[model samples]
Target chain A: MKAGSPIATSSIWPEAPAAPPSGLARSQHKSPGETVAGRSAVTERAGRARTTKRGQPDREPGLKRANFGRGAGLPTLLLLPQVLILVFFFFIPSLRALTQSVLLSDPFGTTVHFVWFDNFKALFASGEYRQSLVTTAWFTVAQNVITLAIAVVLAFATDRVVRARSVYRTLILLPYAIAPAIAGILWAFLFNPVVGPLAHMLHGLGISWDPNRNPNDALWLVIMAASWKHICYDYIFLVVGLLAVPVSLMEAAAVDGAGPVRRFFLIALPMLGPTIFFLAVMNFIYGFFETFAIIDAVTHGGPAGATNILVYKVFVDGFINLDLGSSAAQSVLLMSFALICTLLQFRYFDHKVNYGV
Target chain B: MVERAPILDMICHAILIAGAMLVCVPLYFAFVAGSLTIAEVQKVPLPWLPGDQFLANLQTAWVKADFSRSFLNSIVVALGITAGKIVVSLLSAFAITYFRFRYRMLAFWLIFMSLMLPIEVRIVPTFEAVANAALPLQWLADLLHVADLWKWISGHDVAIALEWNMVNTYPGLILPLIASATATFLFRQFFLTVPDELCEAARLDGASPLRFFWSILLPLSVSNIVALSIILFLFGWNQYLWPLLFTTDKDMATAVIALKNLIPRSDSEPAWNIAMSGALLAMLPPTLVILLLQRWFLKGLVDSSK
Candidate 1:
């Protein structure tokens, strides 16, 4: 089981060694059962170490004699706080969402009925919910694609610059520190229909750009804000990814008469495939769930619910509208979506690690 | 270094400069607007340069938004979450890596599974849980029919009601956000890299697990802890949704959430200058942290993602 699992193999911490010496003067006492357990643990560590060595070459030499084979009481006590928090906040809430999705309860919860699948049925039957699904797909895809494209170009350029590279990186990465809500407000201010210089400039250019009245404009506004905030994140990853490309490979390509553009496209770009893939997954998750604040601040899912992505819809329904059952059902769906993304990421990470990307 | 093409280098510099300008323009615009008077900001073509009313507008924004209180709230909440997450994650990571214990993998996998459930997905249920931190216990007791058993035995009505609402409190704003799988994984990764010989040497010297962890492992992990702390601090500072829902009281609002309140809701022309000033002020702390510790911030960002 340990040999085949990617998670197990990735953790290079060696198994417990034959019961290590206890506190002062306790080292001499060893029962028969303790010796037996210690021997088995040693053999187990040896077997796991052999497997781990195949995947991670940087395995610590101390893997042979590490972990304290003390009683479980201390470790359990240390882990209790995190475990309790995770249970109360994460696991229990997730399970509650799942259960509540199939149950019909008023906001007060004084009366309840177990109406299995009815909430999900109502959610699917609603036109607005379906539209939210479509809007979410568009918003997520556009935000990620645009953000990644710009980040890739900017990061590539930053990588090639001989001077002030750090300056450019700092400037480009400035937006990452701005919260999504602030980013929304900043962009919304820039594109404010009244008193906005950019809006005035657009009007001068013969474009009718009013996000308040136009659904498309609102959607685009949210997308632009989300992408702006995300670009810095993507840029950071891409810059590191570009920098990690071995210099020798680029030098080899240059020696073969490949121009800068040609070298970038054929060599650096291909090497960045895994990083780009990882960023795509991260950006997708960002757009899907984390853009709620941006939407709330900028468009409020406005103008006709054009910007009402599923996450925001969940918020409005669950909190504002107090439709508990339907919101819980939507939450379940969103959780499943997150699960799929996580699974996809793990699979990609496993492949990347195994193939030494 | 590959090839000296001055023109190409200049072009790359130009594109980079242009891209940087594009990224910075909104922030620049925010500053410009914040500096202008309301009348000036309302002009057909807003001023491109900073005006002398900057301090005045900033004062107005500060007073109107009550940023003094909100800023304090934000600082407290951000610090609380960052400290809580780092401490818990460090302890858990140390436990998982240094000690052999039963159900260890079970605990590890449980934390790993949390990566799937971000607070956004289970917002409502999580809110309900937060509203009554003991809701689950109450439900469990109800499921076991404990109240019914008590009533039957004592010939009296009984109720198992436990209430501990977290809303409008510091813990409400911070605790739920502190259970970070990313931070835990980051510390775990760092711990795995610690040479095992150190653990062996400490043990042979008759030191306890916690002693070795404090004397050696904790000191070695300073850099990782610093990097992770910066990331978590920014994360805590930038939080919007959780704080928005958790804190209904005006005094409890974070600076980020309070900035939104500055935007006028009525049809009356909004105070663009004042609102933008608040936005700029709200963004100052995390931006300063990032700018000052760019190296650690970058390291933490890249390392945590991995």
Candidate 2:
């Protein structure tokens, strides 16, 4: 595989190099056949790949096999079940959801109506559908803002405050390490007006409370639960982002006579923008899909449906209602909402993030 | 340079302290409230102290779950899934990072997609496929001659209760639990940091490829493996939806689902106190793991996340 000028075997005939193609003519100065598996395959095929359909010896092995073997191949092997499971379970089901959403199911028989946009129409028409979408959007934005703000503050605080920053960081992440459902459930006990300790404490101090029945109260509690779980993600990003910001830059900012808020806004915040952006992206992703666990636990999107999220709606529709098509329709619609947020992120904040990084 | 302002610093500390209090408040409530009786829990101005009814609540939780068995099942499923994931993800990360073969990108993309896409998208198809697989390790009991072996090991037989669910069988609970793209992703990233020159030199010095990995690569990734173990364990242990789907009755893997069920399907007020207790119970393994492995977990997160 080593690339070099062709050599004459006649010039040095004492002993052959191990596994060398050792019997070459004196000065024909022939180029190597370029058909060898390792060397020429990559070099020649590096440019215009010729179509040698199958069994091409010149074709190199996969990225792993050419470099490592069974022991090294373990990750790929482990990933196989993950891949197979994902493909068979996840991808196929999504594809099925797409298909099922189309064919309207009637009492007599299910038929592939190819209704085209009817499912979507039904989604738009349903009052619950629109309400859920708005609620989900509200949750996503509120959760992201609150989580990111807290995370940034905490991250900066921990970075600069306590001597035991790492310990604090772990403790900060403690809420995250617990299951979302469990956290939600725990918060439920804490925030429940009747039974919750916080409410009890408030009541003991003679403050009547009922988050479950009040719309804003219920919304805030659910958002709080969702946001609390992600505080670690935000904190970690900011911490890492803070770490990546060089001490030299901060010293220079300090040397320039800027207050903490001014320096942060003008200099450090700009540098941390990418981290913030990354966190925002991560927050949207989490808010869209993963919030269901916490939502299930805390409110079950309850009181008067103050916190019913889209994914939870999908769960309700598909699992609870046994209406497959509507859920699939909702899932697609949910994706659009996600897409819009993503686009807004890209269009506006992306520039700042890109520049900062 | 800006002068250090003591007030601003104190304010910052105050805010952080407030945040910390906010974070710890629920955990404080969970244990404190877990001790209250049902009537006491619902009573106006909820009990201020750990009531004598803590044991009663725990008993309610324990029996409601058949929880000793549930706990045993969660452990078995968690352990089974963790082992399966570690072994599988080790192989996966290995295959992905080093193995050169056909459709490697295809494989890589599949894993990446799994990470990107939500699990809800896949649960249905996974259910259909797993349901059709017709796998049975029940005879594993007969093979081992002890349907009671797990019972002996875990000191309880919860699977017997959920046996009719068929998912109580090992393959249903454990086999589907093996897949993890995050581990593969992290491992591959970790592997990339190892010096390729060491590998080349080892191969040149007459070591086989497998030997090169065992001697050179894996030993170096001890920290990474430990980190993956924690993540996979938590993911497996806290798994709510997947196990919920498979275990129709109560076969193992049921605490998370049981907690969901505990929310009072009847419209009578759900038992918040006992539910919190059960949740605290479920959070044990992962929390214990975090407390034990925080050092490595932080290092791993910083290393890979960076």
Predicted structure with the largest lDDT when compared to the true one: 1
lDDT of 2 by residue, B218-292 (tens): 788776677666666776678776676777767455567676666643367757677767777777778888778
Q: All candidates: CA RMSD in angstroms?
A: 8.8, 14.1
Isolated chain A TM-score, each model: 0.83, 0.72
lDDT of 2 by residue, A1-357 (tens): 111111111113213221233111111211111101112112112211221323354534224223654343454444557676666555665666667667666533454467777888999998988888788789889999999888878866765554455556667878757888887777666777765667677777776667777877777777888888779767755665454344556677778876666766686677666557656877888888877778776777787777888878877776677666776777666656555654544343213123212
lDDT of 1 by residue, B186-283 (tens): 67655655676898889899998889989999999887788778888999999999999998999999999999988755476788999999999999
Candidate 1's clash total is 0
Error of 2 at A89 (Å): 1.7
Off by over 4 Å in 1: A1-51, A54-65, A352-357, B148-157
lDDT of 2: 0.62
lDDT of 1 at B205: 97
**Where does candidate 2 stray beyond 4 Å?**
A1-80, A106-113, A164-167, A200-211, A333-357, B1-4, B47-49, B52-56, B134-170, B174-177, B261-272, B302-306
Tens digits of per-residue lDDT, candidate 1, A1-357, equal: 011223322433123111212111121212211211111111123334543665654543222237877578998988988998999999999998999999998988888899999999998899999999999999999999999999988987877786888789889989888999999999999999988888889999999999999999899999999999999998876776565455566788898999988888897787667667778999989999999999999888988999999999999999999989999999999999999898777665554232111
